[model samples]
Target: MCSLLLVYISVYFCILLFIEFLLPFPSQNRRHNQQINQKSSNFFFVFQISFMPKKMKSRYILLTLSIVIAIIAILASQTLFSTPPRVFIHNPFDILYGIKAISYSAITSVCSHHHHHHHRRKPSHSKKKISICGDFPKNIPPPDTDTTSYLCVDKNGCCNFTTVQSAVDAIGNFSERRNVIWINSGMYYEKVAIPKTKPNITLQGQGFETTSIAWNDTAYSANGTFYCASVQVFGSQFLAKNISFMNVAPIPKPGDVGAQAVAIRI
Candidate 1:
């Protein structure tokens, strides 16, 4: 009976040890699950704190840059389009007003220079008048006069040159004598320029209503106002008679603004 009691106590001690071990395993598994959940939460929190704020900051910077660029563009456009058109003076009387404001010595020098130039040009003036009207015995010749000159332009190829600009080009630069260009009655679509080097040129056309030079260019075009002229005369003692200059460029519409398109600039 003592041996039986000893076995019973041993079995009871073994069962108690097994129960304690099983309870500890369950608690350890619970703690491991809690640690894994904490690590996952920390990862998500770090992602939100680090990456989200950076993304937001980048967006804000881009938006700020876009606004600044838009503002600059608006201001620039306003400044450019709001500016007034430029005016140029071509009248001799208007130019004289500015010249008269100069010092006495400057005026004296200019007067002396002009007097010398006038004296030198006096003899040529009579020759020019004779060359122009000498052959026309009548005050006004017929519509088509037989009188000819150094250069003549006829759209139908009846004269030496087919175009007015070709006739002017034939005269070349620095002509001492009066070079006359006779243009027949026709609509000459051309851009004619007599450079400063070419002097003492006379352009005689048929009646003003009969002879015409037309071009399609505006100051707002690729070439500015100074260069957009249908006919530009820069030569000294240059003359144009019985010729109509016209700019065929479309006029500005209502509510639209642009620079002036000049028909002629002398």
Candidate 2:
């Protein structure tokens, strides 16, 4: 509403400027300075008003009011509809723990490098040190014998399918049997969908931190909000555990059209 008002006001002032400065005016009397109407061939009438001292005060007042209103509208719109900043409060203990761990790692690395001068130190230790800061789970659990009709998906090609979408597509549609899909720990960057025809399906992941599915489709790009999800599930009796769905698209500002990006739609 405020935006429309601003645009209307802007266009009005532009027209006012054109009429005041751009239009030609032929003075009938120098002293009288009368207002006159000029008609063009297209039957369009233009009004020419003499610049009097009394009208100058009103014009100034109108200009000042328009400027003030525009500023107020801008500020009000920002205050009402602007997105709030995301705030993260970290635990002080976690900070101290991280600092201590880094310090210990540096000291141990220096000592190990100095003592093992004759021997060539392997680069594996550096990788291990890097893993200390990583929070994702590394271990992939073995599947239980509860569900015989099961498929496995792993990004490392150690399973039945390398992609989650492929595993879902391979499932028998409209199955009465409960099918389980075990996703190994790794990030899968793809959009997944389970149609209504495929029911009684359960998706199991190693852990939420390690097993994450991500896509970057927005509503505008996908044509609608219904099609923009990273994962869309329409199957009955569907279940997902230890899995994270993520839409890695950038955050849209207020007033952005078709900017809705969904993580999961069931």
Candidate 3:
């Protein structure tokens, strides 16, 4: 009986040892649990890397896009609305601020800029103009001594008009292109108005005293406003020589005295 009991104990111990070994490495359930745990950890790792939310990074991307679009819109507007440029300048600064285009006639029409420049453009041909008055001006004389004198003298001859008004009436008929008006010695009384379009005009007098334009010294003379003269010159290149402009008839009163009788409208 003792021998039988010993064999039984040995068999029981062997069977328990076999079952423990199977549970460690050979059991399908244990291997399946290990595989499930590995798959769950891998899923968590992948989700953290791919679906992580970052508000700051998203805001940065959106801001960058917005800035780029704004810059594009501004540049496009300047191109569409701004005037065309006169010169074909590849200015480096234009890279920062888009440049506009313009035409020559438009640019020349406006005399607004203090210092104008041209880049990669052809030079414009400057036009020249002048006026020379002769004795027999197609117009009337400025004024006459007892109705026998003249004022505006041209290349032709002195235009002796009864009144200065008649002389001015015919000025438009005269053409003085880069010419000099040779005025003969005479007390010609008249006021003149020259426009700037007629450039390079030379108004030469026969003599300073003889070629005199006399208007009332004051604005309250005979013709209240037309006391002496009301001449306006708006020419670019103008020349006046040997001409005496006087408003010194202020004997007792001063009407248009201090004012400039001979006005020069450059």
- What TM-score, over all chains together, does every model reach? 0.44, 0.46, 0.30
Ranking by TM-score: 2, 1, 3
The C-alpha lDDT values of all candidates are: 0.66, 0.72, 0.46
The true-versus-predicted C-alpha distance at residue 57 of model 2, in Å, is 99
lDDT of 3 by residue, 138-210 (tens): 4343433442223454323433443333444434433444434445556445556565454445566767877
Candidate 3 or 2, higher TM-score: 2
The 10-residue segment with the lowest total lDDT in model 2 = 80-89
lDDT of 1 by residue, 1-266 (tens): 22233345545555654564355435445665466556557586444434333434454455455455445335424522222122113542432343344345577888999999999877554444434323432422224334323567777766668898888888857867777787878899989888999888888888899999989888878367888889999999988899899999897787654556889899
Error of 3 at 59 (Å): 99
Pairs of residues at least 3 apart in sequence or in different chains that clash in candidate 2? none
- Those runs of model 2 whose alpha carbons end farther than 4 Å from true positions after fitting are 1-147
Tell me how far candidate 2 lies from the true structure as C-alpha RMSD in angstroms: 31.3
State which candidate has the highest TM-score.
2
Using lDDT as the measure, the top candidate is 2
